[model samples]
Target: MSTPKMFNHKTQLILVALATVLITVFTLHANGYLRHSSEQDALYISEFSLIASVPGAQGLVSTKPADFIARCDGGYLVMDAAEKVSKNLTGVLVDQKNRLISCR
Candidate 1:
């Protein structure tokens, strides 16, 4: 003869509670509602200036915002408002006379 296995009531309640909490946490995280502070720090643009230029840049021949684009010496330039260009800028189209132009 074999005996049937059974879960104790307290154990069952604990398991249910744990599952509920886990599901709630998972749901919140999936929806971007719950995130660790460290995760927020990861939300960074590789190129601050390039990201800023997306909406402001019109076209290759089109003119850029005068305030955003500046003239350094020989050519035109695009500067980052956040002033985080050195490390963040991915690529440079032209670097003339300390001016930054073109970004990808």
Candidate 2:
């Protein structure tokens, strides 16, 4: 690295600005801004569990080896399955980015 005496005003300002932006991004990520919250994760898990319990229901999207999600848009598709004693869904929720959001 160059000596402090060799650093000019423009170079110092650029370095300071870059450092500030990096620190801001790090702080936000530390507060859970970079990933989904636990609540969203649980909602998706619950829905996947419900669908998996169905007799013949299948998952349309696999986010993990042990988890899958059934995406719902709308169509005249009729799926058959046993009468679940504790599972009912009226609609699918999506995020602003058009990805599978969750039912919470």
Candidate 3:
């Protein structure tokens, strides 16, 4: 039988740090401090949160994951899947609080 190998101090420290980061991420997610990709796709403006607002940009997918936007740089950043789009957005507007106002 082969003897069990022991990890060195540096390896052990690295492993510990990784574990800590994983645990922290899990805790944040469980506590609702982090939002899922679908939740992030939702556009919630104060004035439009209750009303039937305009939909996402045309030619974009209408699925939960395919259509998502993040407010950035004076506009609602179009999100494709979980990424922000940086091109060819026709008319997207955002407020100071980074809420989506309109997209056409």
Largest lDDT belongs to which candidate?
3
Predictions in order: lDDT: 0.53, 0.52, 0.56
Which candidate leads the pack in TM-score?
3
The residue-level lDDT of candidate 3 at 9 comes to 88
Per-model TM-score on C-alpha atoms: 0.36, 0.34, 0.37
lDDT measured at residue 31 in model 1 versus the true structure, 0 to 100 = 96
- The sequence of per-residue lDDT tens digits that candidate 2 reaches over residues 1-101 is 86567778999999999999999999999998887555534443232223465677766766654322244345322222223522442334444463654
Model 1: per-residue Cα lDDT over 2-99, one tens digit each: 88768888999999999999999999999999867754344443332333457767645436442233334335443333343443332223433534
Candidate 1 off by > 4 Å:
1-5, 39-86, 89-104
Which ranking of candidates, highest TM-score first? 3, 1, 2
Tens-digit per-residue lDDT, 12-102, candidate 3? 9999999999999999999999977653346442232233346863443435543334444444444322335434333344566865665
Model 2 global lDDT (CA atoms, 0 to 1): 0.52
- Give the CA lDDT, 0 to 100, for residue 51 in model 3: 33
